[model samples]
Structure formats: C-alpha cells, structure tokens
Target: MPSTIRRRVPNALLDGSRPTAPSHIDGSATRRMAIVLVTLLGLTHSNPAVAQIEGFTEPHATIDLAATENGVVASILVKEGETVSKGQLLATLDTDVLETTLEVARAQMHSTGKIDAAQADWRSWQSKLDKLRELRTKGHASQTELERAEADCAIAKARLEMAREDQAISALDYKRIEAQLERRRIRSPIDGIVLKVFKDAGEAILPTSPNVLTLVELDPLRARFSVPTPQAASLRPGSSVLVRFPETGRQAIGAVEFVSPVTDAKSGTVPVAVVLPNEHGKYRSGVRCVLEVPPPAGAGGSTSENSANRATAPQKTDGPPGPNRKDNHV
Candidate 1:
C-alpha cells in the first residue's frame, strides 16, 4: 500500500478569510492596460478617418472681350448669359465713316483707267521709237533725233511704271480700309457664354478702354486641389480620380489634367488639376468638391486575402491551457 500524505491549509483559509490581493505590480499593470484601451476608444470615436481630399471647381477659361480698334459702340448683338459660338458676332462700333471709306477704296481697287491709260501711252511711245529707228536705218533721220526719240520713249515707260505702282498702292489701301471696317465688328473668339456686357450702344471705346464683355467657357470645367507631396507623387496627367460635390451631392469621375512638378514651400503641398466634362452646360463652376484617391496596387488583394484567412481561422478559448498545450516562456 502507498503511504498516505497530508497537506496543511493556510491559517487565513481555515478562518474563512480571503487570501492577500495580487501584488501592486500586477495591479498597476492592469490599470495601465485599461488606460491604453480607453485612450484608443476615445480617439476612434472623436475623430473619424477621412479618405478624400478637398478641392474646388472653376471654369476652364475666362475671357475679357475687347475691341482691337477704338470707336463708338453701334450695336450689341448678344446680351448677358447668352450662349455664343466661336466667331459669332457680338457687337459693332460706329461703321458709317469706315464703310464709306471702304467703298471708296473698293472703287479705286476695281478701276483700271490708270492702267489702261499707261498702256496706251507706252504703246504710242514704242510706235514712235520704232519709226525713228526705221528712219535712222534708212539714213532719213539724224543720230541726234533718234537719240532724242529714244529718251522720250524711256520717259514714257517710266511714267507707265509709276502709274502701275500708284494703282497697286490704291489696291493695298482698299484692303487696309476693309480690314479696319471689319475690326469695328466685334466677334466671339471662343465657344462660351457672355457673362457681362460692359459697353452699350453709343458708348465710346478708346485705346485704353476696359473690356467690352466677359465670356466664360462652362464645358469641361476644371477642378483644382492642393494635395500633400507624398500623395501627389501618385498622380499624373490623364489619371482618373473620383470627384464629389458636397453642396449638390453630385459625383463625377474626372481625369487628371495637370500636376505641379514643384512642391509649394509654404504649404508643403502640390497643385493638381482635373477636368470634368459638362457638355450640356449642366454644371456651374466655382463650387467646392472632394477628391477620392485610390489605394496602391496590390493593396486590395492583400486585404481581401487577410479577411478570408481570419474567417477560416480557428477560434481560441478563454480558459486555461490543456495538458497537451505547450506554453511559450518569454
């Protein structure tokens, strides 16, 4: 038979008293753990993570329309907020004087009287010279006479050339006046809408006058953003981005049009521009927006794989380790 062995219980246990509490080191460690967990929870609740960057929308182009020449405004063709096509007539200056001048120039350019008269004169001189040559050859005219006739013919030829030059100058002057007349008619240089009309009919336009009107292109609006340098590195021309308008709750996919190569020293950011198509004139510019950046390559695959592994993993129990379990001694 095996010998019977006996173990003595503590005095506190025999008296029904609780054992001494855990050491201060263990208690302090537990408090520290609780503090860390509370801090993490508070941070998570107070500040939510933001995945998008803020930006603003602006027109692709804004033009101040003005006349190249000075005159009085005769007519305003388009009013404010009117859509205009490229090369459409917008306004006109006083053209009464210019029109009359252009008409006179046209007549001068079309007339051939001077040219015909010069030709006739040249022919008459040539005929006389021919006769003089013939007379000299037959010994019927003196050498001096022949020489004098030759000089006269040359003078007539010079006059004819001068007349031709005068006619050409008149033609050029005609074209110049016609161009001046056309300049008086202001035309749209771009497909856009007139935002303002600064001049009205009968208003005098001087060389230093302000713009006659303001035009802005609404189609293909531009979105501008200031992004951190680290994030800007991933952007390039033609890259796609998700843009959102918070005010209207509208979203669009825009293509990156520009990315500044140099970082801003003061802001520690880089300027970025994206293009959003508004072909139907549905979108207005100067609105606030947000830009969503895409994750790096292969990040989505890794995250999905991790989630699947977690789902298939075995669950752990909170109880003590079993007899077969091996504890790791750190």
Candidate 2:
C-alpha cells in the first residue's frame, strides 16, 4: 500500500521550469495540478484594461485685448461676461487730441486751392510761351525778350511741380492721422465672451500695461490630454474620442486634431489634442475632463497574418485593363 507524504514546492516549480512529479501521486491528481498551474500562468500574461486619461478643456482662443494707442479711456462699450463679435468696438481712448490732428490733416488734404492754383499758373505760362513764340516769328519781339519769357515759363512749371508735391504730402499726412485716431478705439479681434474689463472710462491705458480687456472664445473648444506611448503610437488624427466632465456630468464628442510626434522622456507618455463643437455657448473652457479612446483593431491578433495580407494585396490599376472584352464583341 502507498502512504501519503507532503513536501515543500521547490523554487524551480514557481519559476516555470517543469519540476519532478511526486512519486506517489496518481495520474488524475497530477493532471488536475497541471491544469491549475496553466490557468495561473495565463493570468500573468494577459493585458490589463487601459486606463482613462485626464484632460482639460480650454477656449479655442484667449486674447488680452490691449490698446494700440496710449491715452485716457474715453468710453467702455462692453462689460465683463458680455458676448461680442469680431470687429465689435469694446473701448475707446481719449480721441480729442487725435481727432483735432486728424481734422487739420483732412483740411490740408482737401485744400484743392493749391493744386488749382498750380494748374492755373501752368496754363498761364503755356499761353505766355506761345505768345512769345508767335511774337518772335512775327519779328515783333527781340530774341533776348523771347528767351526771358521762356525762362519765366520754365520757372512757373517748376513751381507747379513743387505745389503738386506739397499736395501729395498733405494727403499722406491725412491718412496717417486718420489711422492714429482709429487706433485709439479698441475693438474685439475675435467672436468671444468678454471675461474682464480691466480699464474703465477715464482710466489711462498704455500699450505696455496690462490689457484693457480679457476675451475668451467658446466655439469649437479644445481638449488637451496625454496617453501612454504604446497607445499613442497607434492613434491618428481624426480618430473619435469620448470626453466626460466628471464635475458637471457633461459629455461631448471630440475628434483627435493633433498627436505629438515626440514622447516625453521623463513620463513615458505622449501628448494629444482634440477639438469639440461648442456652439450655443454650452461648454465652458478651463474645465477638467476624462477621455476614453478606443483600442486599435486586431489588438491581440496575429501581426504576421496582417503583414502578409498587406504585402500580397492586389494594387489598384490606374485605368481599367484595356476595356471590358465583352464590349469588344459589341
């Protein structure tokens, strides 16, 4: 008769190398033990579920709208939390001095009297030259008198050119002054919600100071996140992502817009960004979010089969091989 005995499992058994079977064990018990060991090994090799990545939502754009020209704020046309469209007037600087300068320039540019005077002088000189030539032809005027008259005509022509140059200079000054005046009035550069009004009426604003207003764009919001290197390698732009805002329980569909080519050496991860529609001002920027990305296709399947199929696949021809032979019969 056989007697039962127990012995300590050797480290070699745990290390996956086959161990010698106990001499007294029956075939049935040994098979059962082997089955249990295989199940444990299978569990160790299986992959874990990918964790959700953390992300943050941000405005499509943020602008600290500043004054292009420095002066006392004349008027504040918008308040914080106000929705404004692109090119909408937001604030104005003191334009009293600038407007006066612009008016002076305009007066100079519109002063046609100088140009008109130049033209009249040119015509008068041309007539006098003609008369001088005619007199010389008739032998009524001396050559010296004719030559002096011609010299006078040439001087008038030069004076006329000088006057025309003055007019052009005045016109350019007018445009420059008008542009300076326009810069005194600040306008929104994008369609967005005014986050803050830094300066109010009667306050001085400088180009070097903090911006006059803070603006944020809400439409087409952006979400920024990072993923593990292995997963990021398989991701492509335009891939769909599911986003969840844990704090608000809000959800939105997003599409991958950017994937960083380089991985972070320290963290062993890669950065990515997605764009989501935020029409109707529903989503707010600067909110924390969670992202769920789908796993790649054939994730656990054979790579060799996929590669073979791709290598042996028939390539598309540029045109139909000769026309259909059936058509030739027709």
Candidate 3:
C-alpha cells in the first residue's frame, strides 16, 4: 500500500473497450445453455399433465338397412322415428308370385298318390315274379315268362324309387320357396330406432337402389376422444372417465371401451372410446363433450400439476367429431 506498483493495461481496456471473451469459453456456455433448454423441453413433453380432452358424442352403431333381394315394396310397417326390436318385420316386398309358388310346391310335396301307386305296382310285380319263379322250378312256366316277370319287378321297383326321389325334390323345392318368401319380408337386424325411411310402399327396389332405412343404437352412447399419446398410455379399458357435455350442461361418468394401439403420427394422438348410458334417451348424440384423463403413474402431485398445465395444454381435435360415420362407431 505504501509502494504503488505500475501495471500494464491493454489498449482496448484503456480506451473503454472491454476485451472480447475467449472463443472456447463462449462455446462452452452456449453448449450448457443448449443442454438446459433440451432438458426442459424433454421434461415438459415426457411427463405432460393432461386434465381434460375434447371429443364428441356419437351413436354406438349406425346401420343402413337394405333389401337382399330386388323387388317392389308392397308394404312399409314402420314409420320414421319408430322404435323396433330385432327380427321385427319392418317392410314387405311384393310376394304374390312367391306365395303362389310356395303353395304349389307344398301341394306337390304333400301329394303321395304317385308314390302309393308306384309302391302298389312294385308289390304286385314282385308277387307275380315270386309266383313265376315257383312255376319255373316246377317246369310249369317258360324261362322267357319268368325273365319277363323279374324284369317287370325291377322296373316297378325303379319307378317306386323315382317317385320317392321326386317327393324329396318337391320337399326341397318347397323349402326353397319358403326361404324366398322370407327374403321378400324385411326385418330389423337390431333393436334400434329408425332414423329415416328411404323407400315407400309400392316403391321398386333394385340392385342399385338406395337403402330402405337408417337405424341407430343410442342406448349406450359412444364418446370418442383423440388424446395425446402420453395421456392415452395411462388409459385402459373399463377405466372410469368423467364426460361433460358442454351444450347440454350435463355430466356423467362413462367407462372406457376402447383405446387404439396405433397413434396418429401426424397429430401425435391416440383414439379412445367411452360408453355413456343413455337408456332414457336423455342425451342426444353428436354433441361436443369433454373427457377427463388421469395422469400417468408416478406423477407426483398430479392435481396441482394438471391445474398448472391446463391453460398451456390446448385441446386437440383430430377432425370434426366423426358423427354419423358408421366406421367411427365403437
């Protein structure tokens, strides 16, 4: 302190210009910052706290009912919006010709006069052949007469067999006609409500015709969600999920029915379906809904984490809810 030591200062420092940092030091600091940013990004994506997912409600099944055979519609038993049960007759095609054919086949099948006559003829010929054999053994009948009797018996037996075969064929024809008549009558394949009727009575149905009706099952409504891959991983079939319909201001608990194993590569999402009870027909399908997804295992304080991340996590929609799409139903 007593003696002042002179120290050399750089020109840049003396001129109020700070010295530049070393290239190595700058590089090291940049690398450390890059690593920290990478780590933070990874943590955010790997353990994301997803609370609610947006989805839509849809029917469990949609069916387009059509006739298997081409014919004119004779009668329509159900109206639009009518509830129907499985195997209930919904409509009938023109069956006048088929009915007549079925009656003719039935009469033919039941007719036993030809068979009875053939059996009588066979018995008479067989008896005659036996008598002829005895007469031939006693040298009372000619060999030609015995041979003719045997041939007649064989012919009669063949005729009887032919009559029986004809009877069997007639029975088969009757059954075939009955099946044709049944096909003309349309029946419901499932217990559901008829959404629409495309055909009317006396309308012609051809191979290229439109469907007869549109049916849907709504008892167990299906709610579908496109969830983030991370959230989907924690979901399993039969897990309870809370579903809220924003339009109706109603909420209900549903059971998870399906979770797709494959992920949508473009959206990084997985498909999930839940079954919501709608036995009373209270909830209509095609409504927007929200689904609550629980956090993955080992996620500490998931409640607070989900709350904190709720605003940052935006709900994703793969597309417009897929309502009324038959292939989209669970």
Candidate 4:
C-alpha cells in the first residue's frame, strides 16, 4: 500500500490566473541559442584574405624597323595600326636595277651552249690524245707529237672546267642579286601591329635611314610590377597571378616570367614581370592594371611593414622599357 502523496500547487496554477511558460518553450530557446553560437563561430573562420598589388601591362616587344637596303620606296604594303606577320613585306624599295641584273645573271647561268661547245672540244681533244698515244705505242707517232697532243688535250680540259666555273659564278651572282632585292623589300621581323609608318611610297629609304615603322608585338603581353623584397622572394617563375585592367575592365591570368635578382636599396623592393597571353590580340598594352596575389602561407610581419610594402610597391603607369636581354622579350 502507498501512503497518501499530496503536493501543494501554486495559487496561480489552481486558479489559472496566468499561463506559465511551457517546458518545450525552454527547450526551443536553448536550441535557438545553440544555432546562433554556431553561426557566429562560422562567420569568424569563413572570411577570406585578399592581397592587392599594383602593376601595368606592356607590349611583349617594341621594334623600330629600318630598311636594310638603300633605294626609293616603291610601295608601302601596310599602314599604321595594321597587323602583320613575321617575314611579311611591309614596304619595298626600288628594285628595278636589281631585277634587271638578276635576269641577266640567270640568263648567263642557264646558258649551256658554251658549256656544250667546251665539252665537244674536250672530247675531240681527248680522242685525239688517245689516238696519238696508240700511234706512239705502235711506233707510228713521235714522242714530240704525242706530247703536243697531250698539251692540247690538257688545254681543252681546262677550258671545259673554266666553263663550268663560269656557270657557277653566274649562279652565285644571281643569288647575290636576289638577296639584295630581298633586302630592299622591307619586311616585318615579328608578328605584330604597326604602330606608325615612318616612310611612305615614293619616299627615299636608306640603309642608315631612321626606322621605317614602329611595331609592337601583342602576343604574350607582359605585366611588369615591383613588390617588396619579402613578397618578391616568394614569387618564382611560373607562378600565376590575376591581372585586372582598370581602364578596359578586362581581367586575365598571367604567369611570372622574371624576378630581378637585384633589389632597390631605397625602396626595398624588387622588380617582377609576368607574361600574359594575347594570341588573338584581345588585350592591349600600356594600360594601368592591378595584380592580385595572395599572401604566401605563414607570412607574418609587422602591420607597418606590410603597409609600407603596399605603399611603395611599384605600379606600372607608362610603357615598358625596351627589352635588355635576349630572353627578356617574347
């Protein structure tokens, strides 16, 4: 048997003057609090860091092309802003004289009548020499007669050799004239856009004349920038970076191609270069751009030092200087 269990109830519960909060209400509050805490913790760890660096876009190559031969400009095949391929004729000098000379040389080189005549003469002499040798062996010809025949045969052979030599020289002269003509025809040495045409048709061009045209190579454009020594140290050839052109609103991925070994003592920075592909001529150079590179892992430094790095970082604002080393240009 159980003894009578009695519990005292609150006056409010008995009269139900006001409803108390339910047990489930407390459970709901605890769950909502847990969700809020988890969200706050995630927000703290989910933020990503970004590093901004300054840079500029430049042409892969800039060449001032000059004529190799001196003559009057007969024609200009390309105009400013026109794209051209390597070895494409851009202009031509007067090559009438060279052409005429080449024709004459070709006529001489191909002329075989003289050579045939020489061959006939040589065969005749050889036959005569052989006959003379046979007659001398049979005691029908004197030694002096055989010697005279041999001399004549040798002279004929020399004449034939001279004819061949003349033909070879004529062929060589024709090639020389052709090479000279080619030099007079100014051609683009690289695939690029003509920035300016310095000479036009009917103008005179000289071997020592100033550049005939200014060409800029666009493919594989270069982005040159400077970064703090520490940041630059982490950059290696083949490293990729994001390049953003502020003027054109274009963005591209570029790869590091150069890291200068020398550092600027005053700025404590090093020069760096990245090559960006523009095979389709989609990108133009000489524009201000920014490079976005994430900080290296485990990179920790003073705040002021980092700020200085950002402040003193080199930004490309002008056209890049001409390439110095052979490998520097694309």
Note the Cα lDDT for every prediction shown.
Answer: 0.66, 0.65, 0.70, 0.66
Runs in model 4 deviating more than 4 A are: 1-50, 300-330
- Candidate 4 TM-score, true structure as reference: 0.74
Q: In candidate 1, which residue pairs clash? A: none
Find the candidate with the highest lDDT and give its number. Answer: 3
- Give the worst 10-residue stretch by lDDT in candidate 1: 311-320
Cα lDDT tens digits, model 2, 1-330, are: 111112222233345454344444445534433333322222212212323577788987899888876689889998899999999999888888778888888888778887788788878988988998998999988899888888888888888888889879999998888888888878899999999888878887765684798999887788888777766766678754545576865555456789999988877778888876666666678877766543344453343433232111011101101222111110
- Which window of 10 residues has the lowest lDDT sum in candidate 2? 311-320
Q: By the lDDT metric, which is better: model 1 or model 2?
A: 1
Model 2 spans > 4 angstroms off: 1-51, 207-210, 300-330
Candidate number that wins on lDDT, 2 or 3? 3
Sorting all predicted structures by TM-score, with the top scorer first, yields 4, 3, 1, 2
Pairs in steric clash, model 4: none
Give all TM-scores, in the order shown.
0.73, 0.72, 0.74, 0.74
Candidate 4, residues 1-330: lDDT per residue as tens digits?
111112222232244344322233334433333332222222212212334457677888999988876778899899899999999989888888889999999999999987899999999999999998999999999999999999999999999999999999999999999899988888888989999989888888765675788999988799888766666766788765555676765555567789999988877777888887675666678776666544454544433344332111112211112221111111
Which stretches in model 1 have alpha-carbon errors above 4 Å? 1-50, 295-330
Clashes of each: 0, 0, 0, 0
RMSD of each: 23.6, 19.2, 20.4, 20.5
